[model samples]
Target chain A: MTRSPFTNPYVLILPGFLLSAFIILWPLFQLGNISLSEVNRFGQIRGFAGFENYLAVFNDPDFYGALWRTLIWTFGIVIGSIGTALPIAIVLHEDFYGRGLARVIIMLPWAVSLTMTAIVWRWALSGESGMLNSALMGLGLIDTNIQWLAQSSTAFPMQILIGILVTVPFTVTIFLGGLSSIPDDLYEAARLEGANPFQLFARITLPLIRPFLNIAIVLNTIYVFNSFPIIWATTQGGPANSTDILVTYLYKLGFRFGKLGEASALSIMMFALLLFFTLIYVVLAMRGEKE
Target chain B: MKRTWLLSVAGAALLSLNATAQADTLRVTVAEYSSKTGPYFEEAATAFEAANPETDVQIEVVPWDVLLQKLTTDISGGANADLSIIGTRWLIDFVDQGIAAPFDSYMSDEFNDRFFPTFLSPSVMDDKTYGLPIAASARAMYYNKDLFEQAGISQVPNTWEDLAAAAEKIAALGDDVYGYGMQGKEIETDVYFYYAFWAYGGNLIDADGTSGLDSEAGYQAAKLYKSMIDGGLTQPGVTSNTREDVQNLFKRGKVGMMITAPFLSSQIATEAPELSYGVAAIPEGPSGARGTYGVTDSMIMFENSEVKETAWKFLDMLFEAEWRSKFTGGEGFLPVNKAVAAEPAFADNADLKAFAAVLPDARFAPVIPGWEEIAAATSDALQTIYLGDGEVEATLDGAAEKIDRILGN
Candidate 1:
């Protein structure tokens, strides 16, 4: 059929494409430019120095340490949120009293800023006068107050828990949307076939929510990988930079030390890593559905 | 319709040009020291605008923690204010990058004579004044009097040996009371260690221009703090407490003694009026050496600021004795203006007198390019040692090596 110019795909998408290019691609172009140059602390370009900044990132021991911690932090938070949120979404989906209030309560944390939540958690977890230690002591859980943010051992795990906590509300919202989309008939048909409760969940509910779970996984991975405030507000990736993930370490190198060239390089590297994981995950997810 | 839009755009442009030609907006980025900082500056700006009708002053208040990052991002984007408040230690980097404009031409002889020499000296780099000290403070030991009496401590400890004994006695009078409130976290963690390091006769940089972190003073200082932590004389969680946290404990009367800036006095005044505390010189170490940290946050002009003269006028007004007295008195900062320091509001204050008593021994942060990184490195090393995760000797040596490498650059 002869198409109108208005209906042409390229013509329809041109404005949007240009807007996004101006918004994202321009700063990206600048970042790439800075990455390849010998830049001064104020991000003023001094001269061209190809690959030197990237080489510096590869050589630093702190970069490697942060890279490893970043992997753990991302996986721990993403998986923990999903693992916790799925059951929560399932519970909320079922017919129950006060489900409306329950949903609102679950969604409340999402409304507060992450920085405020983190700051509140910091005070709650303080060593001497923390609410947590007092509660623990009142319950006789331990003889003495624990220094929660003293070092990596307790601090990293507590940070991951807080990260998981903040990520759950968003994850649960996605899950609830997926759960509601599944028709009641699907569960009934399986139930009439004499499937047990766990069997019915495995057979009907799991597959129905697969796509939403996939979306949740990819988005949460991208978000948790770059999250800053939870670690920053609590420990500032410290007790000797022991809790530093790539983002916190990136901040220190870029803002704290004013190493713009290396910071830009690290930013580009982190972007590539997230992009690679997302693409690979989507491919694997689509292939699994096909099979 | 298109013609109408074009005419409107043109009219708006002329309106803006008319506004700019009438008044210049002199923007200043201020670091928020306390809740009172913003209102104080806003009041100052209103007074400034009232007198200098051609200038409309804008004050952007940034918190202390994010001030540098904000300034860096602002500078990189060419969106920085005409003036900013920066830590004097960070002045070298600003000068090296040519981001800070020299105020030499702007400073008249009388203007130069206003500030105390000690406070003014840190901002003088390469013999050109790059900044003016806007707020100054020095560290001193604050002890809880009741706790000292209960522990039956007759005199405040003047030496390390005596201080350790006093700490033991205070710890013995325990009901969750700590003898020493040592800070092992966040900003100034390294400086907290330096009190003893300086007292034990160490330099931040050795005579040969290398880091002195691995020297006898360094080893002895770390050993002393670690021993106290092990001996349960300091706070329970050494590495968990920040300077503010320790200060909070002191205000709560849980900490027997802590070393901090003079601002803690103002904090205690309003928060705990009956805390029964006294400020004294930071205890000396062996060899009769003692030191306290002297910090000055300086007001600087940016190199790219289009409104330099008006900005200088504001600076001159700010440095005047009347304005300086109000600011210094309100913010609890030591007065950098000599005339303000002589005012009874500052001169007659007992807690301030204790802080001022040690001004001769005040060691400002070394003016170097990589000072932040060096401080971070030293702080990280100290935290590691404090946590008992790394051996003291090895950690200090490793940190010293790292600092020397940075210095070498």
Candidate 2:
């Protein structure tokens, strides 16, 4: 038997690996270079600044506020969506009337453009003329309107809720795929052994879908951490920069304020933070599987 | 052999592109102000092309919000158009970077005389003209006439005290109706605050080149707005409503008064024609000092452009009285051209006259390198004050320190 050269793993993977490396590493390198240099407003690098940009980012009080909010934004949306989507996926997995329609409806929001959805939500959440206020008033929920986006106390929470709302569609799809891959025979055998519904979920469904669940969490954390439109389209991180997450803050720093050097530094730091979190999660999940 | 064929094909494409470049194509990046803006420029380009048979005018319309970002990327890539419409406030940065070329050599005395100096001078730096004012506007107070009549206030408020009184009366009328529409979010939030800041005799920059926000004028102006917000004179949730949100309330007759740009008048014209509203001067403070915010968008020639002469001719055609008047009227801009200002459509317009009346007191955003950062700092402080999260004096003082740092004072 003659072995083909292309059958070797290194030979098979080399081109694909290089293509992905160029696609990803080139911008990462540019960002790192810009972060270490004195970049003008037009992104033209002037001279080496030797970590000055990162130092400025560290010194800014607004950057600290944004960093803190970014954590809350990422966790609040990721946890909330995963929690909501799990039950939803389990329910849809069961045979029910209009099941196909339910699946389509569940996935519908993912089809709409995020920015368009956010803009519509902005109008609906208005203080005076908003449909939300009118609906709440009609239901006798409150005597007066709630200015939802007026203060960070209210606005940030509302923004988190919006993030979770938009994030559920994608998370649920992942869960559904995981649920379908779990053999029905395993659940039937668990029931034959007189396992309860909760036991079935815990032993059969939970263990089987653990990998997908972890993947959903890691991806959602990254997406929600960097989500811009929900907060930007609504409040623009205003009312005193109170609701700014890192991405929105980075945008204002780079584009609005034209502090490209600091923005690049902040971007690199955010990328590192996301990378660290994902790496820890993946390694822990892999170790758990190994054990 | 294949590589040679590919190289020849690439060379032929490049040669063809160069030949087309010599065909006198003048590219202009226009900022879209309204739905009408693109068509207006396209029409002007068509006319310019007809007049100069050798020249082909290309219009690339960009939205106002992303114009600067687009220009920055385009410039960094060396792919910018020959001309672009930019905020006059941004001209200082462009000039400092040598991105924009001075048009002084292109401007004859008569050509220079065509523009109102108040409109044109904002784009001038270091004794050179860097931009031509393509659109100009100033802010004025718009009041609901029916609300004033219902409140039994027949006269326009010329001072803050009178405005407060009128607002109080108007607020007493109903629960849903708000007396004053104050914008505390998004673009121009600081400028909205500056209406009172300047009224209280504040200068954006003091003689020592420090920010004037920590002075008595700043405290008083902030106090006035805080009091209005606290007393329920403004709409509930002052920090939530953007300029457009407040303007929407005004159009619906829910807001008694709003201070906004001349564009709002045109917005009201089409959106709420039946709503009887009157434009008036922004009310003054106790010292009787008053000012209105003047904003201009300028058409500038890029320093990198190879077709400056053709771009200048297209600009000359754009600034001609007929086109200028048409553009001004269609977009509800205050005319930048002297002849366009004399046209009956603008001269006979009462709302524009009120905006024109404040020409002497019009304060363009000061030309500084970090003006955007300074504006952001001011806006954040104002928002804090409006939300009652921080004391007015302390917030303004903190903002002043921040701005001074940006100014390198």
DockQ scores of all models, one per candidate: 0.78, 0.85
List model 2 lDDT by residue over B129-238, tens digit each: 99999999999999999999999999999998899899999999999887889998988999998999999999999999999999999999899999999999999999
Question: Which stretch of 10 consecutive residues in model 1 chain B shows the poorest summed lDDT?
Answer: B15-24
Q: Which digits, one per residue and each the tens of the lDDT, describe model 1 over residues B24-106? A: 89999999998889998999999999998878899999999999999988988899999999999989989999999999998
**lDDT by residue (tens digit), candidate 2, A1-291:** 999988999999999989998999898999999999998888888999999999999999988899999998899999999999999999999999999999999999999999999998888889998899999999999899999899999888988888898999999999999999998899889889999999998888998999999999999998888899999999999888999999999999988888889999999999999999999999999998888
- Model 1 C-alpha RMSD to native: 1.9
> Candidate 1, residues A85-146: lDDT per residue as tens digits?
99999999999999999999999999999999999999999999899999999999988999
Worst 10 residues of 1 chain A by lDDT: A186-195
DockQ class, candidate 1: medium
How does each model score on TM-score?
0.97, 0.97
Model 2 regions more than 4 Å off: A1-8, B1-22
